[model samples]
Target: MTARPVSQHAAGTLEQALAMLAPPGLLVGCRRIETGDASHILPGESATILSRAAAARDASGAGRWLARRLLRQLGYGDLAIPRGKAGEPLWPAGVVGSIAHDADFAIAVVAPSETMRGVGVDIEPALPLPPELEPLVLNSRDRLEGCDVAIAGKIAFAVKEAAYKASFPLDGEVLGFEDIAVDLPAGTVTLSNGRRVGVGMSISSHIFALAFVPAGVS
Candidate 1:
């Protein structure tokens, strides 16, 4: 509900708007979503991103096109970012990124591999997470402050998801909700084993979280 900075180029459809709002240190690209058009897919990528579900296909295809554009920024055009067995992006050597969508908006955020150990970003509608899942996600240390239960849940879930994505590339570690605790107001997620990642969360066109592990961390 709160407004975020708008880019002068954030025009056209929802996807177009987000392409202009790439997070710091990232180059984002996006396209209009379409279930019927898989034109955005490149060689060796369709098997990973295209799904039987119409909405899923549209969202994924749009993100792929955006990723390909960002690839241009990296001086590679034919690179195929397939999905791994773990359902994560198979980033080419020296490249990393994340893709996310909320409704009609789909986006890809990419950066050179040496810049980060791992990176991820996610978007959710402003709506809250379901109450029944709260006990499964909220940690004992979490302080929701004065926020409504749903909003608080959203914050925690988004942060945890981002952290998991950011760490997966290097650790290949399957993390449970309790393994990573989220601090909403502070915009951070701390792992149980003493590791922490920087997380940025906000309400722009929707709720979003961008996460990354600094390069020097092991």
Candidate 2:
């Protein structure tokens, strides 16, 4: 099968954006979802998406495709990342990571488990948060001041989702949107369990958000 050609311009832009949002110890990768991206899924990764629709499977495959590439950089050979019972990616021992994708892009971020206790990443369209969702996602504690008013709700929602992902592996508790609080200027999210996670974001054609819990921090 023929491989999709890489776009130098898009790659350069994504690299720049990632550098701005990634912490010092993280390895981040991004890819434009391509037609044959689903072909990258291995047997071990197939079960997770068996019940998903064709398009959803493609997105899942694209995420794993990028994830495997990042893991390879860490000296892990083409390992398959299975989905956890709660739907989180199950990374290899000694590593912590997250994968996220929207209609057009897929992103993955990884770090040594010793350096990062937990990490989560998410992507969404740059559009405004739906009116119905805004009520469900935002609360009095979230601070959106000094942010672009148009996408403020989107930012708050994305960061909260990232924070939930970062915290769930350690806490093993399912949390609601109201269970997370965000301070955009401070770039932090506080979970109801009292854990603090650092957040970073990039907004261009789409919104990309990342949350992390540093080792030794609770």
Candidate 3:
């Protein structure tokens, strides 16, 4: 089924949003707050937000903001946000996860156990690739093959972002587009470090593309 773009503040209600994003059998809940709210409150569960405007710094910044608030609500405590050697965000002990924020939305996923593994989430607003910049992002083979250039560029961007989050916790490696290769048709990514990761992506024609990956396993 084609993924639908969700925007209304009350789109599905907090209960419904949790139900839609959480894995089966996992209890989930969410609360909406004014951007000015001083604090977020949750006991021990993960929470995320899809903000309107002020909450997010930019399209992508919103996602990170939501993720941070969700972490706080989950009872993870204020994140120390240590910089990994590779400049990735690192959470305190007993936590393993990632956050993805975009222009109009933000999301954060957290798991109690390291066993839950590392998680990376990314979202990009849906837009046509700039004709002049397309060639710089895609290789000659892709350009000559008459493939879907726009989709290819988007997938590449998404995969790189996903890989950055997935691999950050392990060694804080800064990954570039050349360091990651994506097989969108197969929903897979191969890193220069010789690790292979699985990806799940949701695409809405006029909205954005969202991708997620669990940490450590790949």
Candidate 4:
């Protein structure tokens, strides 16, 4: 079997998934990366885009490309979005967004940075996280309290990650597994530092969580 290089323009599967989840004010875009397409992606990125190593060029590049299109649709045409100290995308002055990638998938979501503080989105293959991580990610209450629900800990992990991405820019605070906890019943994520963020989940061939907060509100 042969592997696809990062330059192939293979068809992508993320379009319909993104369309289904688009909200009224947010613009979303995604691509399936069979190959990294370095010729275009590298030129589109700068040295400060996460201090990324050569190996990560494809994933980061594809994710950013999708973000660019989404932003353009919202009037941020051909903007140069950089990365911050914590590896977050430094969107235009009034734009907020997030990017995520799996082995062969990448996605981005964006909204006005004024009223909408930030958009956090994450994607994971429909597989269970390893048992070892269950202790670290899932709180004991949500773990044993549930009578008999068949869900892998991956959704919780993804939700926490998404929440972290959306909340960090607003609060400008460092976050950790212990700092953020998932409330399945509430369909929300709570932070130990005193904040509750709204989260929405989508489960198909993949699992996705899109969390958002208004400016100055968590």
lDDT of 3 by residue, 1-218 (tens): 12124544532253354345444222222223234322332222122323344444233333334556556755765544433444345566766556554434445555554445555655555565567755555543222123254566765566567656866665567776667766656666677788666555545432222233443454
Index of the highest-lDDT prediction:
2
Model 3: residues with Cα > 4 Å off, grouped in runs: 1-7, 10-65, 72-87, 139-149, 205-218
lDDT tens digits, residue span 75-133, model 4: 77777666787888888777889998877777898898666777788988768888898
Q: Candidate 2 — which pairs collide?
A: none
List, in order, the clash count of every candidate structure.
0, 0, 5, 5
Tell me how candidate 2 scores on lDDT: 0.86
Rank by TM-score, highest first.
2, 4, 1, 3
lDDT to native, each model: 0.70, 0.86, 0.49, 0.73
- Rank the models by lDDT, top first: 2, 4, 1, 3
TM-score of each: 0.83, 0.94, 0.62, 0.84
As for candidate 3, its clashing pairs are: 59-102, 59-103, 63-101, 63-106, 118-215
- Supply candidate 4's per-residue lDDT for 180: 82
Query: After aligning candidate 1 to the native by TM-score, how far in Å is the CA of 167 from where it should be?
Result: 0.4
Candidate 2 lDDT at 36 equals 67
Candidate 3: worst-modelled 10 consecutive residues by lDDT: 41-50
Candidate 3 at residue 84, lDDT? 43
Among these predictions, the greatest TM-score belongs to: 2
